[model samples]
Target chain A: MDYISRYLAWLGDGIRDWLLNADDTGHKFALMLVAIILFVVVMGAVLLAVDRPKRVPRWLVTVGFVGPALLMLTFGLVYPGLRTLWASLFDRRGQNFIGLDNYILAFTQSEFQIVLRNTALWVIVVPIAATLIGLVYAVLVDRTRFERVAKTLVFLPMAISMVGASIIWKFVYDYRAVLRNSEGDLIAQQIGLINQLLVWAGLEPQQFLLNTPFNTFFLIAVMVWIQAGFAMTVLSAAIKAIPDDIVEAATLDGLSGAKMFRYITIPSVRPALVVVVTTIAMGTLKVFDIVRTMTGGNFQTSVVANEFYRQSFVQQNAGLGAALAVILFVLVIPLVIYNIRQLRISEEIR
Target chain B: MTTTPPPVPALVTGGVGDDDAGTQSSRRGLGLDQRAAKAKKRLTSPWASLLAAVIAILWTIPTFGLLITSIRPQSDINRTGWWTFFTNPTVTGANYQEAMFGSQTNLAVYFVNSIVITLPSVVIPITLALLAAYAFAWIEFKGRNVLFVAVFALQVVPIQVTLIPLLTQYVTWGLAGSFWTVWLSHSIFALPLAIFLLHNFMKDIPPSLIEAARVDGAGHVKIFFQVLLPLLVPAIASFAIFQFLWVWNDLLVALTFAGGTRNVAPLTVRVAELSGTRGADWHLLSAGAFISMIVPVVVFLALQRYFVRGLLAGSVKG
Candidate 1:
C-alpha cells in the first residue's frame, strides 16, 4: 500500500511538472507523440487480444470496442452535465438552494436581457444575411472562369479562428480621429476599409464596435463573413445535386435568368437553404470567441455563451453562468428540431 | 447509381452555362473579354458576376490588409493603415519576432501548447469514435438504437454547461490545468458528433463487405482495421480535417480548463488575452492572430476538397 501510494504521488508530480513547464518544445513534442502512440497502441492491443479466429463472443467484442468511449462520455459529459444543471439551482457560492432565481434573473435583469437581445439579433440576422450572400455568390460563380478561386477566397475565412477573424474585421473597422494640418485644413484619412469608403463618399467614420445596437450587427457581420462560405459550399452541392434532366426541362420550358432562379433554383435548393440557415443560426447562438476577442462583450454586446463565460469564470457567479448555459441549451433545442424537421421534409420530397 | 459516377460535373458546368447565356451576352466590356468569347456568353448575369467580384474583393481585402500589416514595421502599422503601404512600401519581421519571443507575448510557447493539445485530442477521439462507430454501424447489440439516439441528442449540450462541473471534477482528481485534462475533455466533447458522422459514413458501406470478411474468418477487430478502415478513408479524412481545425481553433474549452497557465493554454487563449489587454497594438495583434491561424489556414487550403466534403456532410443530405 505504501509503495503504491508513493508511486502514484511520484507519477502525479511528474505529470504536474510536465504540464507546468511547457516551454521545452522539443521535449513536449516528443512526449506528446509518445502519449498519443501509447494511447492508440494500448487500445489497439486490447482489441486484437480479445479477437479469436474461430469464435468471438459478441458481448466481449462489444465491451472491448465500445466500453472506453461509453465510460468517458458518461463520466466526462453526462454526469458533469447533470451536475451543472443541479448547480444552476444553487446560489452564487453553490452553498444555498435558490431554485430558479438565477434563471429568472437571466430573463429579467437588464444586462442579461441585453444579452438575449443581442443573441436574438445575431440568430435572426446572421443566418439570413449569410445564406443570402452565400446563395448569391454560389449562383454567380457556378460555372464562371476561375470558379474555384472565387469560391475559395470566400471560404478562406471559414478556415480562420474566430479570434483571427475578429482581428481581421477589427482592422477593417478601425477608426482614427480626424486631425487638421498647420493651415487648419482637415486631413482625416480613414484607415478601415468601410470607413475609408465612407470618407471617400464624404461621410463620417463610424465606431463599428463601440456604438450600441449597431455594434452587435457589426459583430454579426464578422460571423456572416466567416459562415457565408459554409452556406455557399453546402448550397452549391445541393444545387449540383438537382438532376440535370430537371434543369434541362426547366430551360426548355423557358426558365432562364430571374425566372429560372425564382421558379426552379430557389425551390430546388430550399432544403439546403434551410440547413445552412439553421446550422449557422445554431452556431451564431453560441458565438463566444468573436465577442470575447473583439470587445470582450462590452457595450451591450454580450451574448448568452459569452455571458456564461464571464459569469462563471470572470465574475464567479456559478448559478447565473449555469443558467445562461442552460438557456443556450434550451435555445438550441428548437433550432435542432426545426432543422431535423426540414431535413425530413426534404428527404420525403425526394 | 452503383455502376456509374455522379452526373454532377457535366450537369453543373453545362446547365449553368446554358441557363446564364441570355444575361451574360449583353456585357461587352468590364473584363468580359478575358473569357473566351464563347465562354463569356455562357457566364452569369453581368450584375451577378459584378456582385460576386465585389463580395470576393471585400472578403479577401481584410486578410490581405492584415497580412501586409504583419510584415510591416511597427511604426508604419501604427502611423498608417495597411492600404498606405501601396504608396510607401515598407516591411519588417519585427512584429512576428516580438510576438513570438518577446516579453509577455511569447506566442511560440502557446503555439506549442496548441500543437500538444490538438494532436492527442484529434487522434484519441477519432480512434475511440471509430471503434464506437463501428459497433454502432455493424455490431448488432441490445439497445443499440436507443444508445445511438442518446448519443446523438447529447450533441446539443453546449460545452458551456459541461465546463464548471467538469472543472470541479478535474480539480478533485488533481488533473486540472494538465494536458491530460484537456485531452480527456476534448475527446469527451467530440465523441457524440464524431460517432454520429462516422456512423453515417459506415452505414453507407455495403453489408456484403463486412459479411465477406466475417465469412473469411475475420473477427470484428480484424475486419475493422483491414476492411472497413480502408473504404472509410474519405469519410475519415473529412471528419479528421474538421476535428483538426476544431481542436486547433477551440477557445472556450482551452480557456476553461487551462486558463491563466501559460503551459497548457493554446494560441487562441493567448491571442485573445493579447487582443483584450493590448487592444490598440495592431502590429502585435495582426501578427499574433496570423501566427495562430497559420496552421489551420495551410491545412484548409491544402485539403480543401475534404474540408468541403465535411461541410456538405455536416449540413446537406450528403
Candidate 2:
C-alpha cells in the first residue's frame, strides 16, 4: 500500500510539473508522449484482457470498445452543450436565472439585430452566389484540355485556412488614400489590386471593407471564393455521373448550348446542387474566422458566430454568447434536414 | 458506357491544319458516344474556353498575388501592389526570416506547436473512434441504431455551442490553456464525425471475412486486429489526412484555449492575431500566412485523392 501510494505521488508530481505546468516545448512534447503511452497501455490492457484464454463476455467487449468514446462525448460535448443551453437562461455570471432575458436582448437589441441581419444575409447570399459561380465554372470547364489544372486552381482555396485566406483577401482589399504632389500631379500609387483597378478605370478608389453594409459583402466574397471550389468539386462529380446516354439523347434532340445546360445539366445535378448549397450555408452560418481576422466583426459586420465569441470572451457576457450559439445551432437544424431530404429524394430519383 | 480517351494528345500535338481534318473525320459516321463527344466539342466554344480561363485566373490570382507579395522586398511590397512586381522585379527573403525567427513574431515556435497539437489530436480521435466504430458497425447491442443516430445528430451542434461550458470544465479540471485541453477539446468535437465516417467504412467490410475469422477461434479483439485492421488502413489514412488538416488549420479551438500564451498557441492562432494587431504589417502578415498555409497545401496536393475521398464521404465540420 505504501509503495503504491508513493508511486502515485511521484506520478502526480510528474504530471503537474511536466503537463499542467508545461512551459517549454520539450516539456509539452514529453507530456504528449506520456499521455499517448498511457492511452495505449490502458486500451491495450482492455483488449488483451478480453482476448485471454477464457473468452470475456460479449457485453464486456462491447463496453471496452464503446465506453471511452461515449464518456468523452458525454463529458465534453453532451454535458457542455446542455450546460450552455441552461446558462443561456441565466445572467452573465451564470448565478441568477434571467428567464429568457438574454434571448430577448439578442432579438430586440439594435446591436444584435444587425448581427442577426448580417447572418441572414450571409446565409442567403454565400450559398446562392457560390453555387451559381461553381455551377457555371464547372460547366464551362467540364472537360477542358486543362481540366485537372483548372479544377485544382479553384479547389486550392479550400485547402487554405480561413485565417490565411482572410489575410490574402484583406491585402487584396488594402486601401491607401490618394495623395498629390505640390504640382498637383497624383503621386500615391495604389497598392491593393481592387483599388488599383478602380484607379485605372478612372473611378475613385473605394474603401471596400470600411463601408458599413457593403463591407459585409466583401467579406462574403472571400467565403464564396473559398467555397466555390467545394461546390465545383461536388457538382463536377455529379455532372460527370450524368450518364453519357442521356447526353447523347439530349444531343440527338438538338439540345445544345444554354438549352442543353438549362434542360439537362441543371436538372441532373440538382441533388448535388442542394447538398452544396446547404453545406455552404451551414458552414457560412458558423464562420467566425474570416470576420474575426479581417474586420474583427467591426463596421457593423458581426455575424452570430463572431458575436458569440465577442460576447462570451471579449465582453464577458456568457449568457448572451450562449444565446447566440444556440441561435446558430437552431439555424443549422433546418439546413441539415433539408440536406438529408434532398439526398433521399435524389436517391429515390436514381 | 463507352469511355473514349479524350483527344488531349491529338489536340496538343496535332498541327492546326491537321487538327480540324482529324477531328472532322472522327466526327463523321460515329456511334452515339462519338456524337456525344462531338457535341461536347461544340459546347467548348471559344467563348466558353475564354470564360473558363477567366474564372480560373480569378481563382488563382489572389493566392498568386499573396505569394508574390511574400517574396517581394518589404519596401516595394509596401509601396506598390503585388501586380507591380512584374515591372520592378525586386525580391527579398527578409520577411520570412523576420516573421519566423524574430523575437516579435516568433512563428517558428507556434509552428512547432501546431505540429505537436495536430499529431495527438489526429491520433487520439482516430484510435478512440476506431474502437467505437467497430462496435457500432459489428456489435449487436440494444439501442445500437438509436445510439448511432444520436452520434450522427450531434454533428449538428456546432462547437460554438459547447465552447463556453467546455472551457469552464477545462478550468475546473486544471487543464485550461494547456495542450491537453486543446487536444481533448478537438478530439471530443471530432468524435461524432470520426465515428460516423469510420463506421461507414467498417460497415462496408464483408461480414464473411469477420465470420470466417470468428469460425477459426478468433475472438473480437483478434478479429479486430487481425481481420479488420488490415482492411482499414486506407480508410484510416483518408480520415487521418482530413483530421490532420482540420486541426492544423483550425483557429477557433486553439484561440479559445491556447491563444492566451505563446507557450501553447498554434500557427493559426498566432497568424490570426498578427492579422488583427499588425493589420498593416503586410510583410509579416504575408509571410506568416504562407508559413501557416505551407503544410496543409503540401499535404493537400500530395494526398489530394484521399482528401477528396474523405470530403465526399463526409464533409461535415470537424
Best by TM-score: 2
* lDDT string, candidate 1, B1-318, tens digits: 111111112112222112232334334232434334524644736776788889999889999988998999988887767788989998789999999999879999999989999989988989999999999889889988888888777877788888999999888977788788888898998888888888877878999989998999888888999999999998788778888888888889999998869878999999999888997888899899999999998997778777766544443110
Shift of residue B214 alpha carbon in model 1, Å: 1.5
Report the C-alpha lDDT of model 1 over A48-81, residue by residue, as the tens digit. 7778745657888888878889998899878888
Clashes of 2: 0
lDDT of 2 by residue, B31-114 (tens): 555545764686558888788889889888888999999999888988888988888898899999999999999998898889
Each candidate's number of clashing pairs is 0, 0
TM-score each candidate: 0.91, 0.93
Which 10 successive residues of model 1 chain A have the least lDDT summed?
A: A15-24
